[model samples]
Target: MIRFIITRLLNGVVLLFAVATIAFFLLYWGAGDIARQILGASASQETVDLKAEQLGLNEPVFSRYGEWLSNAIHGDLGASWFTNQPVTEAITSRMGVTLSIVIGTVILTAIVATILGVSAARYGGWRDRTLQVVSILGLAIPGFLIAIFLVRIFAIELGWLNATGYIDFTDSFTGWLKSVTLPIIALSIGAMAAVAQQVRGAVKDAMRQDWVRTLRSRGISENRVVYKHVLRNASGPALAILALQFVGLLGGAVIVEKVFAIPGIGQISVTATTQGDLPIVMGIVVFTAALVVVINLSIDLLLGFVNPKVRLS
Candidate 1:
C-alpha cells in the first residue's frame, strides 16, 4: 500500500510538471504580448518595451519558464499583470464561493445518486426504468443549459431566488445557501446521472455476492443488510466515479460560474485568459491540476483501505 501510494504521488508530480510546462508555453506563445495588453494598444513602443523588460518578457523563454516554475514550486505564484494582486491572494479571496458550490454539489450528488441508485436496484420494474431514463436525460443535457433553465424557472418565473448573485457565508448562512442553491443544482445534475448509473451497477453486483446471500439466509433485515453491508462494499466504485465527477465539476464551473455571475476561480480563469493575464491563468491551471491530483490520491487511499485487494495490487 505504501509503495502504491508513493508511485501514485510520483506520477501525480510528473503529470503536474507536464501540465505546467504545456500551459506555460501555450500561454507564452499564444497570448501575444502580455505587457502590451496590460498597457493597451495605444501605449508607445518605448513604454511597451520598458514594461516587457520589467516583467522579464525580454528574457529567453526557457529562462523565464524556469524562474516561474521555481517560484510556483515555492508557493509564490507571482502577481496578476492586470489586477496587480498576487495570484494566490486573488484565488484565495474567491475560493470560498467556488468551494461552497463544489462541496454542495458533491453532497447533493451523493445523496440523490445513492437514493435513486439503491432504490432502483432494490425495486426493479418501472422504478428502475424511470431512473435510467432520468439518468440519460441528465447526461444528455449540458450543465450550462441546465443552469440557464434553472435560472429561468426558479429565479425568473418562480422568483424564488436571485437570478445571479453571491453572498458571503460570514454575512448570512441562509443568504449564502439561497444564493448558491441554483448553481449547485445545475452543477450536480450531470454528476448525479453519472454517479447513479455507476452506483446502480455496483449495488446490483454486490447484492449477487455470496456474502449477501449468506446474510439473507440468516434472516437479517433486508434494509440493515443492504445498507450496512452491501452498500459499504459497493461504495468503492461509486467513490471512484465521484472523484472523476469532481474534476468535471471544476471544469464545468467555468461556464456555471459565468452563468450564475459568481466570482470564482473559473470566472477569473476566463477573464485572465482573455486579457492574457499569464500569472493568474497559470495560477488557476496549476491550482486546478494540483487539486485533481490530491483528490485522486485521496480516492486511491480510500480504495486501498476499503478493499484490501486493491492494496495487494
Candidate 2:
C-alpha cells in the first residue's frame, strides 16, 4: 500500500508538470504584448519596452519558461503585470471563496446523486426510466445556461438571494451560504445527473453478481440484500466517479461563477486573460493543476481502501 501510494504520488507530480507546461505555452502562444495591454495604447513606446524587459517578455520563450517554473517552485508565482501585486497573494486572497463554492457543490451533488441513484437502481421501473430521461436532459444542458436560468428564477424574479459578489464564511456564514447557494446548485446539477447514472449502472451490475443471487436464495431480507449485499459491493465505481467529479467541479465552477457574478479562481482567470495579466493567469493555471493532481492522488489512495483488490493489483 505504501509503495502504491508513493507511485501514485509520483505520477501525480508528473501529471501536474505536464499540465503546467501545457498551460504555460498555451497562454504564451495566445497572449499578445502583455506590457502593451497593461499600459494601453496611450503609453509611451520606451516605457512599454522597459516594462516588457522587466517582465522578461523580451527574453526567449524557453528562458522565460524556465524562470517562471523556478519562481513557481519557490512559491513566487511572480508579480501580476496588470495588478502589480504578487500573484500568490492575489490568488490566495480569492482562494477561500472558490474553495467554499467547490466544497459546497461537491457535498450537495454527492448527497443528491447518491439518493437518486439508489432509488432508481432499487426501483428499476418507471421511476428508473424517468430518472434516466432527466439525467440525459441534465447532461445536455450546459452549466452556464443552468446558472443563468437559476439566477433569473431565484435571484431576479423571486429575489430569494443576492445574485452577485461573495461574503466571507468566517465573517457571516449564513450570508456566505445564501450568496453562493444558487451558483452551487447550478454547478452541481450536471454532476448529480452524471453521478446518479453511473451509480445506478454500477448498482445494477452488482445486483446481477452470483453473491447477490446467493444472498437472495438464502432468503435474506430484501432491504438487507439490496443495501448490504448489493449497494456495498457496487460502491467502488461510484466512489471513484465521485472523487473525479469533485476534482472537476473546480474548473466547472468557472462558468457558474461568471453567470452568478461570484468572484473565484475561475473569475480571476477570466479577468487575467482579458487584461493579459500573465502572472495572474499562470498562477491560476498552476494552482488549479496542482489541486487536480492532489485530488487524483487522494482518490488513488481512497480506492485502495474502498477496494482492496485495487491495491493488490
Per-candidate TM-scores read: 0.94, 0.93
Least well predicted 10-residue stretch by lDDT in candidate 1: 304-313
Give the whole-model CA lDDT for all candidates, comma-separated.
0.90, 0.83
Best model number under TM-score: 1
Q: Which residues of candidate 1, in runs, are more than 4 Å off?
A: 1-7, 305-313
Q: lDDT per residue, candidate 2, 1-313, as tens digits? A: 6777788778878887898898888888666777888788999999999988887777878888898889778888898887688999999888888898888888898788878898898888887998899999888999988888888888899988878878888889888878999988988888899899988998888887898889888999988997765776677788788878887888787787787777788888889887888778888878887787777777767766666656754
User: Which window of 10 residues has the lowest lDDT sum in candidate 2?
Assistant: 304-313
Regions more than 4 Å wrong, model 2: none
Q: How many backbone clashes does candidate 2 have?
A: 0
lDDT score of residue 190 within candidate 2: 86
What is the Å distance of residue 49 in model 2 from its true position?
Answer: 1.1
